[model samples]
Target chain A: MSHTLVEINNLSRFYGTLQAVKDVSFTIRQGEVLGFLGPNGAGKTTTMQIISGNLAPSGGSVTIANHDLLEDPRAAKNQIGYLPESPPLYRELTVNEYLDYCAALNNVPRAKRLSARENTKERCGLHDAGKRLIGNLSKGFQQRVGIAQAIIHLPPVVILDEPTVGLDPIQIREIRALIRELGRDHGVILSTHILPEVQTTCDRVQIINKGELVLNESIEGLEHHMKSASLTVAFHQSPDLQFLENLPGVKSVHPEKDGRLRVFHETEQNPTDAILRMAVNKNWGLYEIRPGRLSLEQIFVELTSDAALENAEALATTTTTDSGL
Target chain B: MILTIGIREFKSLFLSPLAWSILAVVQVILGFLFLARLEVFQLYQPQLMAMDGAPGLTEIVLPDLLGNAAVILLLVVPLMTMRLVSEERRNRTLALLFSAPLSMTEIVLGKYLGIILFLLVLLLMIALMPLSLLAGASLDLGLMASGFFGLALLLAGFAAVGLFMSTLTQYTTVAAISTFGALLLFWILDWSGQGTAGGNWLAYLSLFNHYKPFLEGIFNSADAAYHVLLIITFLVLSIRRLDADRLGG
Candidate 1:
């Protein structure tokens, strides 16, 4: 297994009475890309800032490469590179000059600073724009410069907050490719609200809603969750709802318009084979039987929407009533 | 780390047209004043030669020229120092430094030293006007050096105040104006206490009062200490402000 590069334990931050992050904890291992997914104002940026040592956590701790962020900030910060929401560029400086400054600031040795800068620029596709002033470059090129600065020191962990925002589609694709490339060697934490960006780029995904981790799963596990757990079938002649619900391996049955029935089942007990056999034996002319899958977008909405919270509360009250009986 | 940041800061100043324009304007204005003082010295050279206690070219030209330079710098230093921290905050680039493996003290001191380096170059240019008198007549190097030293100390104090003010706001204009206001208040502080009973402390508190002695070739430790103290105090405050930002209020 790859070694853990960043360990954030119970990290919390409060802005006066408003708690921005509440006991958030996660770890990133080397060569893993962790997608930090959240809705707007979900405290993603605040958490990124705390992890990068730009802001102190109101409670809890963060360790970067075994160095406690609060106790040994210099050592911890040295092990990570952060690109904030807005790329921090000095508009007047040339790309080469800015990269050189970043290298120096990151303590790349004097002899190796030039190589570090050149290699970063080349990797970020800024080779030809070395002489151009950053202010004059296109937004895409400027963003590359921002990324170049972050990885110039070759830190073990790289944190990028909204790196592809405000870019054209082509630029976005290029940056995503670069981020995936970085993930090969570095433990990368990418925070974004874009769902596909997470699906296409990350090995693991974490969803934060209302300053709390709503879901944490590996990509394969998320795919498994998205797999069809329910089946939708239609009949020329409608079958009894009670019989459909009582079928082996079936969990519940709900009737829909056009004489269709939706049957849900357990994860391991798929009811498709049983339902097909029963429809033929019972003479219920089944025309359409399709498996239902949940898209990531729906999952994200279900996890983050206010309706989800209310649904959870309603479920809790019913469970209490059942237990009381 | 401080040198790396300082060098970058100094180089960045030249990348903007503001620094070049300020340099050009200051040189033109101070150069013209230097010539005017030399002309005045020539006009009174014969009358002074006959006097018992005659002040020579160094005594007459250096103090007036350097004093005018100080006043001009009083206005210009704020402009130079205004963007030191405030622009970084406004542009959201301070995060670059904050996330780097550097302490607030290193960042603050590096910026301070960067502006001081630029001011030292301006001071060298101003000193050349007095040193040119060495072509024909004997010059009092001690008095010239002391006058320039006083001006350097005064500019250092002004820069510290400007940096502190810059840390107080994200707006560059606000930083510049507040620095001007604070420096102006310190400049004329002694005036309010003049001729009043128990006003000696106020006079001592005034930046100009301490600077006045150095212009007269009086190397008083108290004046030097005063300027150093002012520099340290404001720098410490600036550092504290940055720490507050990191910890969040």
Candidate 2:
């Protein structure tokens, strides 16, 4: 029995008439690295903001570690850290000075600020670049500095919104590794539209569409959802629809005009068992039974396409939000 | 805690080129004003010294010295205060300050005190003028001391207003422009006869009018109370603006 670290209940946000987060509710268990997935404007950032106590929810409530957000915000906020889409770096100061300032701001006592600074520097890969000014650092290093500021106070929940929006491949991999490392100790909520990010880094995935939680499950469940298991069998001779449909555990069999049959299997029922049964009964030549895999890109496209997302601003508008980013 | 914030703000004000520039320019102008004022004193001191033991040094030079400082403060105090919270917010450093352990009151007070400290340093630099005047002329000590007090109170009120404006936005340009406009209006709009013609009561409400008593080296309790009240009003407004982001209550 794990204690819930963050519990959001019926949280909804509206920008006047537009509903950003439509009744979003979820509980994040302690030490869980939950990935928040959605196309732009699917309420990922809004939900993240609510969890971090940065944005006020239009309805419902958030309780962090049993401290109600509306009642005991200070205590709740003290436990969570938030890094916005932009790293929020001070260009004039060196990485060390900025982090030290953040440390003092986050209430690291005078006696402990040095040790906290040392710890964050090591954890965030800033040990070698502390003296370098943030303006002079590369994008990746600047991002690392952002992470350092967010986690310098040893917060239990670190909310990162689009942490890898503008990074190269190698930088993305390094940041992923860093996120995984942080997840070992801190409960991290990472928001990104990049699907592979979830498959690789998240222990659990929640996909929201049109401000509604369309899918809320573990990473394996996501893999299963995207994994098209049942095969399509094209036969040389025709088989009766009833005979194939009567097959045990065959959820549905759609007969193609070309004498082929597409089968749907209940996730619990193995297609292999029913396929063997079909072969013995039909005595028809089985031309091919190929496996199908839905790439993360395909699933993302399918999940966020015009018919799917109902709001396809990810293409034209996320760019608008990135000016400051 | 307020003192700590004040010291940090004081350091930041001095470290910035703007503060240094304002200090130098104001001091030079005061220095020149003091020289001309000494000429007038030289013309009149003979008669005064001849009559019943001349009034000591603080008298003759204090008005011109204080008058020049008043003009200088009206020009520079707005610039000194415009960037306080506005720049922090513009550079995104305000978030760091917001999340820090210190409350908004401390930040505002610290930054306000820092501006006051900067003004004091410039005053000290200007004090050199009167010290030189003392070598050759006579002026009243009480009058000079009162003039400095009046100037401090006047600038303190202006700094408070500027600090309030800084909290209004994340754009330094907007903050600076609006603060300048607001102070300028306060300093000159009384000529419109709004405060004086059928609005004598409203005229009394203006910060400059309240501060005029201090400039004359008169420590009126009503004037002191007016400045203190205005300062508290702006500080409270700043604190409320900061509380907008806190979770719930």
Candidate 3:
């Protein structure tokens, strides 16, 4: 349990004068599936890039298996297998040829290349597609090939940047399954804006907003952390606020202008069974009820939009400061 | 591992339909030029190979052959280099190469060696021309070999330039055209001064100037050193550019 697979301390990256990632630190333990959650251009990719050694950090250090990344990137890097946003692929080569090349570049040893390629192919479900050219494959098969190449060397840590991007629903499920299986044995850090992806697949979730880590917790604890829980309820004539507020679970009832009421409760309360019983007792003609779970999308917008609003205000204040002088 | 990368790049070239078309085009051009050079010799043989002012085969035929080969290599090298880094950038495949365990030096050297190995195969197809000369007449194989060696050096330097330029953009057409233009400028810089004026310094800077001594069968170390220096300079610059991308931050 104490095995720190990845230790990041105050890491940051700056592109010229602009800061891309800033003051982010986290430790991932062995066998943990860490879901890196962020919206577009929120430094999730930049952080992942730095951790994977494709981009260097402007500040701090990342240690993989106790090896410092800055001091010994080769040794640190050898412990990592990264699948970036667009799977880096050789379009002209067959899958077997590409994986064999990946194995060699990854230092898998000459004699073991075949076995390594087979292992990655089997794990990534690319065994049948091994002989096909990557460019000729459909987007789904191409994604599988990308994952196959990343894990060819069997590194302890696998970093995937939006592994499910541009895939159909079936492809998304297949890739998520692949990710889950990979996380079982390898410490996997994946970034995606797909919130349900985080809920269903990840063991831990780290949400970065506007270059700063806004939320870092396990999926199990995420629901508990929110101050409010949304519960959907249906009643005859759309039950009034006093009825919901009086319930033991509910904190407030913010009635929507659309005649439907959105009842918010304390995070710890389930409110489903209780709200149902209350509705029946009152004979308000209850129609529906559900406990609120923040879809990954809503959470991302809430976090980033909030941050952006704050940033806008800060910009205004600075502008005023300059103009007043 | 370096050889492995080289082999992968070499194989990638073969996978394309255009590579075959380019090969056929180059062969046709070379074959046509060979016939033209032979015809010119036949027409001017009386004055050129006179008993009183006889032009040795080495002096006339070998220089002419090497000059034509120099032009062919220039056109061919750009085609090979077009995808080296630019395509990787375009397809976002550079991330894979960068994240791999190999160093920048290994990747760069591997690609150069791959292109060189491919050029050698093309050289083999033309091997018969010199070999036929050896069987039919008394010829200096060493002198002819020097010409091949010079061709290889020029290719090495130009390939490095092409590879470095490839990293500047993601468009293969831009990379190819830029490399061709850069090499054309080098070729012109070498001869423009001797024909006109005000370009002697440019000629000294031209890559072709470094190559000419070897073509003349001089076996000069300075020429070899110049080629080596240019290759190293460009390669180092490319590596440093990637270094900035990955770590200079």
Displacement of the residue B90 alpha carbon in candidate 3, Å: 0.7
- Model 3 local distance difference test score: 0.82
Instruction: Summing lDDT over every window of 10 consecutive residues in candidate 3 chain B, give the lowest-scoring window.
Output: B125-134
* Ranking, lDDT, top scorer first: 1, 3, 2
Task: Put down candidate 1 lDDT per residue, B200-244, tens digits, no spaces.
Answer: 777769988888889999999989999999999999999999999
Q: Give the per-residue Cα lDDT of candidate 3 at A157.
A: 88
lDDT of 2 at B144: 70
lDDT of 3 by residue, B1-249 (tens): 778888888888888876677677777777777667767767887777557757666566776777888888798888888888888888899889888877878878887778777777777656556556666567777878888888878888888888888877789999899999988898778775786665677787888887888878888888899889988998898788777668644
Q: Interface RMSD of the predictions, in order shown?
A: 1.0, 4.3, 1.7
Relative to the true structure, candidate 1 reaches a TM of 0.95
RMSD of each: 3.7, 6.4, 4.5
- Residue range B1-249, candidate 2, lDDT tens digits: 566557666776765688889887887777778778777877887788789866544655676567667767777877888888887766755555544345567767777787788877877787677766667555566777777777777777778888888888877677777877777677664555564556565566766676666656788999888878878888888777766644331
- All candidates' TM-scores? 0.95, 0.85, 0.87
| Candidate 2 structure quality by residue, lDDT tens digits, A104-124 | 666678899889998989988
Q: Model 3, A195-296: lDDT tens per residue? A: 889888999999898789988888767766543478766566666677778888778887667556778877677677777787788778877666656765
TM-score of chain A of 2: 0.84
lDDT of residue A129 for candidate 2: 96
- Model 2 reaches what TM-score against the true structure? 0.85
lDDT of 1 by residue, A1-325 (tens): 4899999999889999889899999999999999999899889999999998889899999999999999999999999999999999999999988898998899999999889988998899999999999999998998899999899999999999999998999999999999999999999999997899999999999999878999999999999998857888998888888878887778999887766788898888888888889899988999999987888898898888976679889999999999999
**Candidate 3, which segments miss by more than 4 Å at Cα?**
A226-299, A308-325, B39-53, B191-200, B247-249
| B-chain TM-score, candidate 2 | 0.86
